[model samples]
Target: MHKILVVSDTHRKDENFYRVIDIEKDVNLIIHCGDTEGSETQMQQLSTAPMRIVKGNNDFFSNLPDEQEFEVWPHRFFVTHGHRYLVNMGSTDIRREALVRGADVVIYGHTHKPVAAEIDGIYVFNPGSLSYPRQEGRKPSYLILTIDDEGELTYEIKYLELF
Candidate 1:
């Protein structure tokens, strides 16, 4: 199986970043949903796997793309920081954009809340925030996605501390 690590909204804090990197070293792909707060350079150095990072609203100094669409062979993903999509209000904007882009899945981060659900023939996911979480109990978190050779996909949310 091929594994992918997904995280977002670090906001310049990286206490749990290395921990995730160490635990998921077997995974060669990492996706940052943005709001890194100018920590791209450090994240790049510490990442053992190739990383795809977007530009969040807070990433004013960075020139990363606002959104990205890529494939893992048979699986297409739409990734964005979500401000353009108005994620703080809801996922409608993202849903519409994902559909237009012909993506199988949408990965985004903006609300600092962990979300995982399949909506309207598409998969919508948010890894929450690794440094700051706004969901119930407020525990930092991230996500792990695995794709089998047969193209089957599995996902799980791993929190820094048990809620």
Candidate 2:
């Protein structure tokens, strides 16, 4: 089995964000959706594994890609920062891109709210913000996706309190 961690919108203020993640364990992949704030820089301080990332609207990652598309474990994923596609109102462009890329999952972060929806057999997920969260008046958050060697997949959006 593989455990994949997903985080976004860190905006960098929380020094404890890294503490909540046990990257040394059974984690097979890491995905960061952007706006890591200072967290991305701090995140860089510890190189755990190959990470997939995109630049958020407030993210300072100029070198990061505007859109990142990849396929893994027989599951294709498309990711973006969401601002360019106007994801807050729903992303038609991204949906199209996902179709074009033949993605089974579409991941993005920008609105700072956790969103999980499926459209036309395509699964779209937003891990929410690690430093900022909009729904349920809760603390920051992220997500965990699991895929077994047998090709079974499951995931959970984890809300984290990094105070």
Candidate 3:
């Protein structure tokens, strides 16, 4: 089985992000949708697992790509920060882009809102923001994606408890 950690919008704050890295120590891969705010290098080094990170709107000086595509056996993922795709409006634009890219999954962050759903056969996910969450509970959140031996995927959303 392959375990993956999906997180985004840290905005340079490492407290929660680092804590999560420590907690999910067994993750096989780490995917940062975007908005690391220049902490991409440190974030990558925090975990032994290979990381895939993209540039966010707040990352003015970052060198990361605007979008990335990769495959985990039968699943193809499209990763982006969501700003260019107008995520604030809805997922329509990004979904269209992902369809054009031939991806079965789309991971993104920008609205600082967590979303997990299947739309027209495409899996859409967002881990929200660890530094500044805007969801209903306003808790730092992330997604755990697990791919079993048969390539079946399962996902769960986790929230960090803060005092």
Using all chains and alpha carbons, the TM-scores for the candidates as numbered come to: 0.95, 0.87, 0.97
lDDT of 2 at 143: 76
Best by TM-score: 3
Off by over 4 Å in 2: 14-16, 38-41
User: In terms of TM-score, which candidate is stronger, 2 or 3?
Assistant: 3
Give the Cα lDDT of each candidate: 0.90, 0.75, 0.92
Number of backbone collisions per candidate, in order?
0, 5, 0
Is 2 or 3 the stronger prediction by lDDT?
Answer: 3
Task: Put down candidate 3 lDDT per residue, 41-141, tens digits, no spaces.
Answer: 98777666999999999999989999999999789999999999999999999999999999999999999999999999999999898889999989999
- Please give, for residues 1-163, the per-residue lDDT of candidate 2 as tens digits: 7787877777765543565465335677788887764455557656365688788788664677777887778788898878887788886777888898889888988988887777897888888876668878766777788888887778787766544
Structural RMSD, model 3: 0.8
Predicted structure with the largest lDDT when compared to the true one: 3
| Predicted structure 2: lDDT | 0.75
Clashing pairs in 1: none
Q: What RMSD, rounded to one decimal, does every model reach?
A: 1.5, 2.2, 0.8
Candidate 1 Cα RMSD (Å): 1.5
lDDT of 1 by residue, 1-163 (tens): 7799999999998878878898776886999999988898899988988999999999999989999999986788999999888898889989999999999889999999998888897788899998889999898889998889898878888898633
